[model samples]
Target chain A: MSGTLNEARLMALYHNPSAASELDRAIAQDPAAAALVAEWRRQDAALGALYGPVGQEPVPARLRDIILQAETPANLPRSPWQIAAAAGILITFGASLGFGGSVLVARSGASPSLVADALRAHETYVVEVRHPVEVAGSDAQHLQAWLNKRVGMSFTPPILTDYGYNLLGGRIVPVDQGAAALLMYENAEGARITLYIAAEPGQGETAFRFDQEDGVQSVWWIDGGLGCAVTGDLPREALRAIGTEAYDQILPAET
Target chain B: MAVLDEIEAAIPALRRYAIALLRDRDAADDLVQDALERAVRRRADLRGEGKVLSWLFAILLNLVRDRHRHLTRSAHLVPIEAAADQGLPPAQDGSLALTEVHAAMGRLPLDQRAVLLLVALEGRSLAEAARALGVTEGTAASRLGRARAALRVATGRDRQTGTGGES
Candidate 1:
């Protein structure tokens, strides 16, 4: 056999050592092919020597956390009005901040027009194949920093990977009063979901309230000083599961 | 939960492939995390039980391609020279050849590097590597051959210096 063909056969044999008998016969016949195979084997060993230890190293804690937390059951349902009443009690104890009017409005469980605003933002962006957001999700740090600066609230975007959604980045949209941060996420199947967060000083903690408009489903709630909503064209239960996770991760603990 | 246990078992190998592919530990872990999260979320869609490793590798390769595309579009591609400087270990006696091979790998095109690492470092047959990469088996073998040849030249082990088997 020609040298080039022999090298090709030796290379194949080197990659698939399970076909060792062919390689052995070739090596016995052609010393040059044998040397080439030996060299390739050395290269393979070098590769293993360099990278095999990486696999042997201890898996990181965060990796372990991912597996352990993958299946945490969603939070139990709560009556929205009752949770609003509890929020009202909590807000009453705090020294009346100037923003109490909006807080009181939120407590009555009136669907904040913010839900409509969020849905509009979701509807507008989710249809765009390109430039879905002002900033792309790949530059997440800059996206968060930019949104935080523009929206006037310091917050990190919730990781929705557990729900099969990944951040597609976000943008700041003008709301009824001020700018709101609209963060978008998408699943492998191309379904899109969005979270809208705007500053609502002294809004207190309120349970999730579901809203549906023109085929869009949203669950909006107020926690601490942030009024947030998650909107998507998903079923109520699926949207709630994602909203609950986002709420838990984004909500600041009581101080 | 059972699938999760299987996924956990695959983490080390996934991390190894990521590290070999990206040559950055933090970036490697990040890629692996994305892959694991994806695998866990989509475990129900996985057909058959024995294909988890290849499935996870496929997920990781997709992420790597996505990341490369993003970096390219953003004009933030890290120079291979910089990557070699940052990724290589300190040279030691009897380890110079390994270090050279590692540096040369960084110089390789990402597709070639990926194929080489899958077949050589990961010990995947060319056909299995092709399946993971979503490419035809012939294309994968050719890429593997080109990758090995490039590495041979880059590491100064070309035919001129050593084996005179091929013209």
Candidate 2:
């Protein structure tokens, strides 16, 4: 059917409705307008046919690797404000059980201290020129073995397949008494979440905690002699949920 | 689970778009690479899950614009090549027909090109196109109209075989 300039324009607006009637009428009056609109429809359909099936293409392996590689090290230093607050808490109660519980509660309330470690990690290491991460996720087996050895805890990498974050790998570094383990997971969208597992300071009491600082969120808990912290740039609630999920999956299995 | 799979699924389309826009296979791959890298790194920047495709497109679009401008300014302007390079596979018989459409698309203004790509190629509604391009609905509609008209004129199909004069 011949569609008119005005009718076709209207048809474009309502992509196949009452405008069909208008299009038919316009075509009866003017064939050229009808041809023009028909061509547009044809071209639109043709282009759609040419490029429309793109969603089915497999995600490139190289791009996937690059995204998986974007995991920054979890060594961001605390901000001055966070440092001050942490110092205040450390000095005020000195790791007494009552003081530690109160401190965790107070830090959770503050929001700035909860994710202090995570944000610090993101800011510091994400921009590193040569050494963003000590261990690349590419060495999954080696990193895992090393990390497990470092923390003195035997833990399987959290199965993040359900969360759209895959375990890239892990690394080790010195902590309070011995060493800490940093396991990294990556989502397809290039977001990296780090799981920091270490031995808690013997002097400190066990606590379940969540915190946010400078937009990063972290949740930590001490279970079965190993203290674990999960950190990411996600919202406090999301980080907490992931943290809780990790805690539930890993902590119980180990204990 | 599904969200990651879907995003993983979108990478090919994203790669194709990048290649089309940059016309260099390596550069196109790099664009997709940077886009994916940023996306994974900034996944938490996305508030919720399941909007991964949209978010990836947004990231890809930004990266393409930046790289396009930088490369265009750095290198002297030249007419886009008439055909895909010899090394790349020949346009399949079907896409050969759409080559004219791609050429017409290349000739249109950038603003119009963005709208048409979002609408015709990406299957986005005009409103969605507008949102993606960060333009108003009216502007998107106007650009789309102009794009359609330009394509009609360039293809020598502005008038029917029997029609007398231009409208």
Candidate 3:
């Protein structure tokens, strides 16, 4: 019970029957130790029985879709006509408004494409009834932690209850630069709003720029290397208030 | 394209590991989905020599660790009783024993539980488990030893007393 049958040797034997030759000989001689090994083997077998079939179960459609979509040619570079069309669309609706005394010095970065992606994500996900978000709002802590790590920024989903919106949940969407976090909220009337955050490396602060396309309104800005946009179908003033509140909460105080 | 196929092939094992870790099928699939997303996004960074399965597991273990830290900080532990019956096989004669073992697994420290699952259930070598866990082989072996010992003690108590202690 005390000598060669230490826990380490026993574990090595458990993992590999041929791991320790001397330990095998010792277990054969020691009945008590041999009994312990037998018990562990039985337990291990039970563990196998309990979990082995989980792998054999069909992989969920969502999981398979992720792999399939990642390989699609849709992510390839856009044609010149496509770029011109996008720019024309943005110019028609984009309105740059200066915030008096609150605007930090502006720096160059890719905000236009980020906004486009965020708006597209909002349109795509907000319409889904069965799966609005990847992680549900009831599991807020897990969702926040996951977004923080994957999106490479620390942020808390702003409390929108004061604005009559409750958190529906959030998902990680891919962007041109990296991953973006999209948080969705719903009001009593079933209207939804989404907040999108992505890293805009080396980007400087800017006043909120409002954009409207196909009746969907958005307020987007860059502060402290992070680009954020709040998109919804609400009126411009209402969306601005919510977006401003989110900006105040999500931006680090020192920044 | 080949990497995507490899990812598809590894899905079953990943699901198995996640289910064993989280118990709840929905939560496990969520974890698998997140891992797959991360893997596809970072696939270009994958070196030629690294095995795709191990790389995927490493990503998953990192996510699991993050979740545990978040849960600990929020003090919102998944209710053991509510989660106990999830994804379990239909009860047979040994159902009680299986339940006892399942409950005991929920009690093991996260690190120990992970080591046990990787080695015992997944049939991984100690070194391979260590690689996936980002730990030294020696550390992984010691964790497995402690996990097995803890499991035995927990299940043994249930057998002797007819009812197991609740956490």
RMSD of each: 16.7, 17.0, 15.3
Which regions in candidate 3 have their CA more than 4 angstroms from the true location?
Answer: A17-26, A82-255, B48-50, B70-77, B81-96, B157-167
Question: Per-residue alpha-carbon lDDT of model 3 for B1-167, expressed as tens digits?
Answer: 78888987899999999878876678889999999999999988888753898889899999998875553233225556633555555435432267777777877777888889988888777878899999998899988877877777766632432222222
- Candidate 2 chain B: 10-residue stretch with minimal lDDT: B86-95
lDDT of 3 by residue, A145-231 (tens): 877756666788888999999999998776654477899999999999999988776778889987655678778988877789899
Candidate 2 lDDT over A51-97, as tens digits, reads: 55444565444565443233313234336854565455444433342
DockQ of each: 0.31, 0.25, 0.28
Which stretches in model 1 have alpha-carbon errors above 4 Å? A1-5, A74-255, B70-96, B160-167
At residue B97, give the lDDT of candidate 1: 70
Estimated TM-score for each candidate: 0.53, 0.46, 0.53
| lDDT of model 1 at position B66 | 82
Better of 1 and 3 by DockQ: 1
